[model samples]
Target: MMGHAELKALAAAALLSLGALAPAGAECSRDIAVPVALIGVSITNNNGTVGGIYPEALRAASAKAGCNLVFSVVPRARLEVLFEIGKADILVPASRTAARDQLGIFVPMIGHRATLISVQGNRAPITSAQELLDKHELRVAVVRGYDYGEQYQALIKELAKQGRLFQEVDTVAIARLMQSGAIDVTIMGPTTFSGAVMREPRVAGLMDKLRVEPIPELPWSYSGAYVSRRSLKPEDQAAVLEVIEKVAKSSVVMEGFQRYHRADILAESVRPR
Candidate 1:
């Protein structure tokens, strides 16, 4: 099977060939506009703008590529809708899934471990997926559009069928719901949860009330920039991929992740091919 890097190279070459047929100066250039849609809420503040390791990494890559990039923060569902309609050019830090693969090209950027958080005083222990599933009374909260892998996704579906799931708009809302005791437990990436706690004072204040634990059975998944195949021309897709591959390993991007305490989670490179 072709690996991600190999697939990317193959796609780039094919795209470049098609790009040659376009009018002169039609390739990805400074004049070309790139619309980047970011899913999820802002975690940190950057010069009055949303500061996130993923966004910072993307900005670095965009600068390196000399592409004119515009950023918009939207809910995950809305972001998907925009991508499907060819209104968005890119989605930063998107997870790879069979459904998403049909819509765009995913270039791996980082890896994240899904974690479970619950009220500190809760005595019930949830050490594994089965344990959590056994507790039918526990209300588990999750972000609406998150892809938590096939197994977990299936488990979530089962939970939903049992009326034990709470799908919220974003991490902040999940955190807020947990704080208010509206939900029994919630699952999210530690880095994401930490970023939210750092950016929002209300969520930060509830830290002591929450307990975070890793779900070891759940495998780590890579999150990356998903370039819209429907919206961007082949040359544009290749250019964006080139930029992401280059800056994804650069110091600037690493520093951005470090600032958010996500250095360990950042993917060192596209999964080796």
Candidate 2:
């Protein structure tokens, strides 16, 4: 059986031959990069196998669009820089922001909020960000380059200034820290948190003991994908957009989230309003 890399190479080779006969601007050949920290039920990587809601949706759309995609993994912040410089071609699980609007059109996938997730500890239950901050001894960590919301941004800024924040490369890393008691609290979606715990054997026990609660600070936000204006030629944008639009119109993104997040949480957070 052909491995993933071999299959992708074959597909790219075939696309090149078809590109000649295809109408100009109809073909999309780009290098797509998904951030490493996005793993969970959203983007799962089990050994050499890759499966998840976002990946499934994107893969199907790319094929339909005749997009020649070479998927690579990078750190969260590195993704932002790549998008900014057009070093990258496509983005998924992206949040549309005014700043990002300058980069590309956002095709929304899911609407969700980041919640306060506390690890199992003797510390008093955290009622709010300020309450957690009051205890200077407690260590807090979060996945780097992830933006929760306005309030989350402010809180992390404050935590950073106080030298109390831990920004790790990925959820699995943060989960391991929590398991080791090197971390106490994290701000992220329940789905990602659950996925991280499942991915890391050392943090497997962190699942049941996690304390999840919604705070007014971190409210709902739309997450989606975009095609960089700088990456592909202006004409090729349409093909990339088509790929994004197909995923947005389908229920695959939300369907994938349901496996990890509770129905109520999905309805309240990521499901369409």
lDDT by residue for model 2 over 1-273, one digit each (tens)?
Answer: 999999999999999998876654365655554443356777666675556777777887777667755666677788878888877777666666677888877787778778878765565676677886788987789888887656788999999999999999988888888877788788888777887677677778977787777777777778888778886776678877877787788887777777666665454457762
**TM-score of every model versus the real structure:** 0.77, 0.81
Model 1 spans > 4 angstroms off: 1-50, 251-254, 262-273
Cα lDDT of candidate 1 equals: 0.67
Worst 10 residues of 1 by lDDT: 264-273
Q: After superposition, how far is residue 98 of candidate 2 from its true place, in Å?
A: 3.2
| lDDT per model vs. reference | 0.67, 0.75
* Number of backbone-clashing residue pairs for each candidate, in the order shown: 0, 2
The clash tally of candidate 2 reads 2
